[model samples]
Target: MKTFLEVKQLNKTFQPDKEVEVTALRNINIAVKQGDFAVLSGPSGSGKTTLLNIIGGLDEATGGEVLLSGQVLTGLSEKELSIIRRDQIGFVFQAYNLIPVLTAKENIEYVMRLQGRNQEECDTRVMEVARKLEIETLLNKLPSQLSGGQQQRVAVARAVAATPKPHSC
Candidate 1:
């Protein structure tokens, strides 16, 4: 399978006020292929979240490189990275990070709107994901109106709805 995401020789460290260096990641490397449902499982503070953050472009590495597809993410400007993240990547966090005021459907549509996807595509993807996840009935319900699982399902839908760019985490 072709590589969809690649991390090579990645490293990240935290320097405390006392000047103690804490290594969060060290020479870490991973290659996830297209359509791979890969999971980074480990104990707490085991660098799973740190690796994900690097993949998601939410955190910068102290060294090394991440190439999503053939593009080097570290070289991209913040604005460009933001657009890439908004348009291509989908994030499913442990928490349901949804807007309490927005209905399930609206929350799903938010990313599409930000990406300027046409109404038809947005509707199609939202409906497809909602149906696939059996959340169609909760489309009009706010985050507060749904159960934890339902909200997380919606979050997953929103993330997967976007067609990823040539390479996205």
Candidate 2:
């Protein structure tokens, strides 16, 4: 399989003060092949979220490069990155960033709606993903109405629905 995502010499640094520089990641390198699952697990404060943020284009790296299907993401403008994120990537944030105003079904359909999908298509995709994630019963519930696990399932459903490839979901 071809390389789906690659991170080369990745680094992230946080500077709270002029004299304090904390390095979150350093010289990290990874390559994920198409259709493969990679898990990152470590102790807390190990930069797992930082690495994921950089890979998802939600945060910037201080050095090195990230490639998604051969497109370099290191230096793109926010607009360009947002376009890629909307069109190609699916991210499930830790906080379950579902809209407070939207019900579970509407939250799953949000990305498809933003992509200009018709109502029929969005509805169908949302139903399919909700069912696949076994969240069909929770579709009408608000984020606040659901339990933590249900909310996470809804978040997964939303990301799966928005993904360009269902296989990846």
Candidate 3:
């Protein structure tokens, strides 16, 4: 099968000042084919989050490329990257990142709404994902009202609900 995700020569560097440069990642590479599962495991400060941020289009690498399917994500305009992120990437942040004002149901529906999906579709997807995640009972609760575990579950639900299957490569 073709590679579903590829990271080629990935490098990330941080320069806090002209006199100081910290290399976070260097010459990193990864490939995951369709239906494959992979994990990034490392101690803190080992660039795991940095790598993920680049892959998820939340950050840019100082060097290298991230490709999803066959599309190169390097050097895209911010607007283009935003569209790609919205349409393709799903992130479950370390922090739940839920909007405090929106209930769990609305958090799950937020991306679908941004994608311009109709209300019926958003409602249907929210219900479906909430049921699959066993968060149906928590739908009306705001993030502030949920426990840490519940918030994480809702975060996962939101990511799963927003991420559409990749188009044919």
lDDT of each: 0.86, 0.91, 0.91
lDDT of 1 by residue, 29-105 (tens): 88888878887799998999988888888889999999887678976788988987997688888886888889999
Q: Write the per-residue lDDT of candidate 2 for residues 44-142, one digit (tens) a residue.
A: 999999999999899999999999999999999999999999988988888999999999999989998998999999888888888878889999999
Candidate 3 deviant stretches above 4 angstroms: 165-169
TM-score of each: 0.93, 0.94, 0.94
Off by over 4 Å in 2: 166-169
Error of 3 at 22 (Å): 1.0
Compute the lDDT for candidate 1.
Answer: 0.86
Clashing pairs in 1: none
Model 3: per-residue Cα lDDT over 1-169, one tens digit each = 8888999999999998878999999999999998788989999999999899999888999999999989999999899999988988888988989999999999998998999999998888888888988989999999999999999999998888888844575
